[model samples]
Target: MANLYKLDILSPQGNIFSGNVKQATIPTTSGLITILAGHTSLITMVSKGDIEIMLEDNSVKSFTVIDGFLEVSDNVVSIISDFAMKSDDINDEVIEKAKKYAAEQKQKNDNVPSEIAEKNLQKAIMALKVLEHNKLKRKKRVKY
Candidate 1:
């Protein structure tokens, strides 16, 4: 069996996940980084993308996280993000709403701050990507 390490994911709303995981793939500013047991202690900035975790039972779970920071020390990984949500939590309704809002924001790009509009659009796009990835995973799991 693979060694497990503690992983805690947090957001302004509060703790999103806290438990042991065999492996974790985080979206860092540099790019996606995979951490296993006994990884070097370090800290880095996180980007907007999906976070994939391999649980003790080997089940894979995923979440979408916005800008944040990650710290790894003593076999414990902690992530603090502005926002995050489980893949399963992002349903079709939420995706549609985000898409509509993003389009509306883009249409008013001239009136709204470019940076804010861009950030909103990026977040909405990230959410959609996460949802699509989850759907593909589900499809692969369905045996004929």
Candidate 2:
């Protein structure tokens, strides 16, 4: 049997997910970090990215995460983020609209700070990436 780890993903609003997962990967400020059963303890800041969870049954769950910290200890992983969403909960049309809105924001950001505009663009791009990655995962599952 695979070792199971307790995972709690929380955002400011509330808990996003809490359960046992075989493994998880999250993006940190430095880079991507992958955690497995019995992983050593550590905490690090997170950036805008995806959190991939491998369920015990070999299925996968994913979340789009932004701005948080990841902690792992004694086979337990906790993610505290400012924003997060389950991949399944996100719709394609919503993401497309967000992309278009981001583009518009960029064009109309003449008075806005460059950093803010860049951040908006980055967030929109991350959303698009999450949708694409989840779609591919779902397709792979359907194939198998």
| Top model number, lDDT | 1
lDDT of 1 by residue, 38-85 (tens): 999999999988899999988989989989999999999999998788
TM-scores for every predicted model:
0.85, 0.76
Model 2, span 3-113: residue lDDT tens:
988999998879899999888989999999888889999989998887889999988888888788988887888999877888777777767777787788778758777
What's the count of clashing pairs in each model shown?
0, 0
* Number of colliding residue pairs in model 2: 0
> Which residue runs of candidate 1 sit more than 4 Å off their true CA positions?
103-111
RMSD of each: 2.2, 2.9
Report how far off residue 64 is in candidate 2 (Å): 1.6
